[model samples]
Target: MKIQNAIEAKLSEAFDVRILQVENESHKHGVPPNSETHFKVTLVSPDFEGQMKVRRHQSIYKVLAEELAGEVHALAMHLYTPAEWDAKGQAAPESPNCMGGSKKDPAMNAQGDH
Candidate 1:
């Protein structure tokens, strides 16, 4: 939770945060147990009001540069203005299941071996 805590603190200090959720989703991926490599952040802030979607993402990336450059492998961000959150019923989209790093049986890849 160390990384998650740092992200929450930094974002709160950088923006007028109305709503924020930081979820550690590394377990959902093919990493070791209790890993902190993946995260999903949902943030609603007035600071995003005039910003474009790319800009909002950029701001977050900039704020969490250290984390991104290090242990953090993936960041799924759902950023919105207060009005946009309200319009969307104040919910972020779900993260998709992880599809990488899983091992498969060699027989499964045998082609035309029947």
Candidate 2:
């Protein structure tokens, strides 16, 4: 909850948002129960209107660098302008189920592995 709040506060402060969702999707993944390590952020803002996809992701990554570096294992981002978000019915794609790894590796932080 702390990480989620921090992310929301930082992004809301930095951008002018029409709609924002910071979801802790750790449960949908295969991480330990209640772990705040996976997330999905849907941000609808005018700031993304003219930005490229890579740039949008980079901006978010930079803002959540601290969380991503330690607390967060993966971040699924959905960035859009208000128009784009409205066009899509204000919905983001659901995350897929996680398939656990056969061999455990501490540094293997795979988004797909959850």
Candidate 3:
């Protein structure tokens, strides 16, 4: 949980955070058990009020650059301002199931077996 802790700490310090959830989703991916490679973050802050979606994402990327450069392989971010969160009924969209790695079903492969 070191990486997750770091992410939470950094983001909280960088923004006026209202609600923050840092989920470790590595188990849902192809990585080994207990890995810290995949994550989903739900961040609601007044700081995002004037920022575009890309800008919000870029800000987070900058804050978590160390984690991203190391073990974190994927980050799914749900960012919202207070008004947006209220409009969305205080919910972030669920992350889709991971489709990469050897765990992919053969039938779902884009190319059929040779």
Top candidate, metric TM-score: 3
Among the numbered candidates, top lDDT falls to 3
TM-score for each predicted model, relative to the true structure: 0.88, 0.84, 0.89
Pairs in clash, predicted candidate 3: none
Q: Write model 3 residue lDDT over 47-114, tens digit each, in one string.
A: 99889999999999999999999988899999999999999999999998876744566653334211
- Report the C-alpha lDDT of model 2 over 3-91, residue by residue, as the tens digit: 88999999999889888999998886656677898889999999998899999999998888888899898898999998899899989
Error of 2 at 9 (Å): 1.0
Model 1 C-alpha lDDT per residue in residues 1-114, reported as the tens digit of each score: 899999999999998999999999987766677888899999999999889999999999999999999989899999999999999998999998875535243353243111
Inter-residue clash pairs, candidate 1: none
lDDT for every model?
0.87, 0.84, 0.88
Let me know the TM-score candidate 2 reaches against the reference structure.
0.84
Clashes of each: 0, 0, 0
Candidate scoring better on lDDT of 1 and 2: 1
Off by over 4 Å in 2: 100-114
Per-residue error for 67 in candidate 3, Å, reads 0.6
For TM-score, candidate 1 versus 2, the one ahead is 1
Cα RMSD (angstroms) for every candidate in the order listed:
5.7, 4.1, 4.4
| Per-residue error (Å), model 3, residue 109 | 13
